[model samples]
Target: DNFLGTLGGPGITVPVVGAAFEVGIELAAGGVEVNLVVDASSEFRTTSNVIANSPAGRDDRVVVVGAHLDSVAEGPGIQDNGSGSAAILEIAIQMANQQISPRNQVRFAWWGAEEAGLLGAQHYVDQLSPRDIKDIALNLNFDMIGSPNFVRFVYDGDGSDTPLAGPNGSKNIESVFLDYFAAMSLPVEPTAFDGRSDYGPFIEVGIPAGGLFTGAEGIKTPDEAALYGGTAGDQYDPCYHLACDTFDNISLQALDEMSDAVAHSVMTFAMTTSAVNGTDKGKGLGKFKSDMEYRGSHLVK
Candidate 1:
């Protein structure tokens, strides 16, 4: 509240009302220090979602395993998505190699244009009929599974830890991952379904959804560092949305542990004989919290 400088200079301040309020505060004052840049360029484009299924026989309920395949232009997105993408694809391949037939139909999706606003996954859900939506037992989203300084995050599907929970059986889906991590003795925590990833579309239509995230732009607390072995006060992924988010940006330990959890949950639902639906099945529409908004650039909201 006590600084002003020339616009477009090395340190800009009080350039204008809107710019002043948005990015003029100093980092120490709990506001980000940033240089303002505006291209004002926009365009329309098309993209496709990539999907595949197991050759094995199908069951009545459908289990969707999804991860966004697109990345921001800054980096290759190896950890942000490559970890998740590779995790599911390997599971699909091994399912065929071992010829493991599940009790339900498993659909693997690598969604497109997620950075553009979760467009690909939303389109797929929007195209589904009522019956199609009902047939979907649940969804597993793995948006970012490997961060260099990471913490294992399972979606709080039942809202046990957050106000906005996922649809009906989301708790069951959450349980599957919890059990998997517990069995491995890995420290895990609940992450809210803030509608910032591909799962946003699935949960919006009453489809139970859950997944893992290794933290993005979220600072690691001292407690989390004590549990996960990382530098406290540092971001879980410091290179997020930047060119430095390359293969070296990933933690193989996080990838190994999280990927195992993903595989365990995916296979568990694939073969589960129990019904995941419940009374709340009819209440999923508009379940994503209305109070919070999705700010894609930071992804914390």
Candidate 2:
């Protein structure tokens, strides 16, 4: 079955969690909370499931940090998503260890069926109400962040074309990344938002989105290689969608750097989101408070 109709579909990871909660409540009413239960009918019936962790903030606002868990049929997808997923897990664990309570709630989601086209992310977005969505400040999607041979690039979600505009005077999410890249002196190619990965859902609903991709599918031209440090004639990530995308295809140094960068960005945003371009002060709380003045006002005749 062509499950998702279009490119991306729901991996059903969270939905399965929701279902498990339903089943657990039903079963536990008899007074025994089973430690290990299996549900063959659940959408995420795979041996592997994305583990999610949430740090609730004081105001009930949320910021999402995401990576995909499942691999493609063609390859193990270690570099494609495994690296990103591991990074998210590490960041979550670090934050928890630090006991740093963020100003906004932070959610780490590991999506499934992304290669089948961004499914897990799509389903989660589809289930939210406008009010529910407004509580989301922005989504940081890490699809492919580690490749032994690749060029690092951040999403230019707001670049010309359709323009990555958002509701309620949302900030420009892309700038934060650009600034980070510039600070690091890394040669970055801004990948346009092409509805290619999980960031699709956030873009569709006017949520400011940004992410890092260590090149996949695209080739690195001589010019790009000269700017970055890869072979000019080779594909950006030669193993992309191929069976060679295993652990050996990744770089420990690259993974460590990217993971640290991701952690910095996540922590920075969680602590003081008021400075981020695409985030609105009220979006985190789902309401416009009387005291928070609107930066842009209309001309009332």
Candidate 3:
């Protein structure tokens, strides 16, 4: 072969006896122009989204629970998103183990390439027919659920705290978390629902959505520090998007509390027969635009 490059990853096995191609890297002076050729390794790669669905006992409405199962290139992204993915996967496994059924079909999606500009989640949404889109009653997304200096950040579904709001019935989802924390005597704060995570795709097409976030690169205000007992003026996640975001970077207390709320909200929507947006159990008229701005993973603060 004239130009050769090795190709192997995860489950694929490459023969050990193959010779590595000689790398040709050329360098030239900063101002002097010269022809340069480098044998940089390259290959086309592909990834797929993981989706599990449980059929509804009677109703056809669907409640989609989603989390991104990817990390940035710079780090392991443990607290950035591993926390969210872990919480939901455990919930899914336990639900199957217990053989629990819900009135509405529950779809759990571990999205691929979310850190790559929400590609997987957006592709899933883009492929849905209008009827299919309408069949989705609501979406619950969990991202960055446990930061080291975490705050209990529930999305402002009704826009009372923030300027942005979700589609109708999103307030109900927000209320679910608020009520849960209130019952436990925990202080809560509302985070702007600006479609920063996987939920961005769902809400863009008018699907009512809401979820929990502990915190990220955003600085922890003095009031938030007082409430959550973390350092004031420090970032909610000091290791966010960094190589230091290993399991050790997570706060066990934040994970425990946020995960409980995640389960509570999931179970609440699973059993409820009520329509999220006053539509006939997801068979709404059509899709519409959300008022919030859509944000890419890398672009988010």
Candidate 4:
């Protein structure tokens, strides 16, 4: 018997259970023969739910930070998302413990079913009113920040280098992270704005959005290895979506740096959306491009 599984969609089949079956071939000096047979079964269903969140005060304007909380069924998904989820949770806890207040409300979200095509984040955005959407100052997403063989990858918000770019104010958001890495004397690379994660929904609605990524199933190049000191030919996270993606799959060094960067971004935006939205002393520096279009190839991880 064979057990097959489909990831994030219908129609695709992958072997998941049962023993390997092979047909042996025997050859005489002039003749050889072999035969094989296969069978499969599948079921599909759909469900819905509300996205959960904890809101801090100062609701007139909002600074949203998010990470997906669920993982693929193939593995525990510790590094694929547990790394981002845990880091954001700690940041939220510390902010509360320190009693840090912000000019704009900070809403931390733990999105669900992201691996199933960003369902959670998209649902949240789709349900929002126009006014509600306009009130958002910006969004910062964090995903897969602890790949064992890592590269410090930031979203290409400005599209200056990559084909994808975010809304009008997104360049400013990217600058914050770029500036931080530069000050730390750390090398960084730009990941395409390919809408592979939760940030997709936010950017689709013209929200100034940016985030961090330490590569995933993508192979690291010799150039990246030279800059980041990891094996050139290996996937950034060899265990991605596999049973080995447990707590032990993470890289602490990469996690520490990324967590700090997350904290810095959260705190910076909490204090002011000036750099992000160009608002000063509660006055707008310029209007946000509500009609801004999303330009990029979608990479559905």
Instruction: Judging by lDDT against the true structure, name the best candidate.
Output: 1
RMSD of each: 10.1, 14.7, 10.5, 8.6
Task: Tell me model 3's lDDT, rounded to 2 decimals.
Answer: 0.79
TM-score leaderboard ranking: 1, 4, 3, 2
In terms of lDDT, model 1 sits at 0.79
TM-score of every model versus the real structure: 0.81, 0.72, 0.78, 0.78
Tens digits of per-residue lDDT for model 3 on 45-135?
Answer: 6889999998544335788999999998778988878899999998889788878887778899999988778889999999999989888
Q: What do the candidate models score in CA lDDT, each in turn?
A: 0.79, 0.66, 0.79, 0.77
lDDT of 4 at 192: 84
Q: On a 0 to 100 scale, what is the lDDT of residue 163 in model 1? A: 74
Off by over 4 Å in 2: 1-53, 58-60, 160-171, 273-301
Candidate 3's C-alpha runs over 4 A off are: 1-44, 279-301
Tens-digit lDDT string for candidate 4 (1-301): 3333445455666644333333222333336553445564455655544232335545657888999888887789999899999998988788778676666678888888788788989998999899988888788999999999999999887787898778767777787788778867889999888989998998888788888999899999999999999899999999998889998999999999998888877766776635366542221123332211111211111
Cα error, residue 108 of model 2, in Å, equals: 0.3
- Candidate 1 clashes: the total is 0
TM-score, cand. 4: 0.78
Question: Model 1 Cα RMSD, Å?
Answer: 10.1
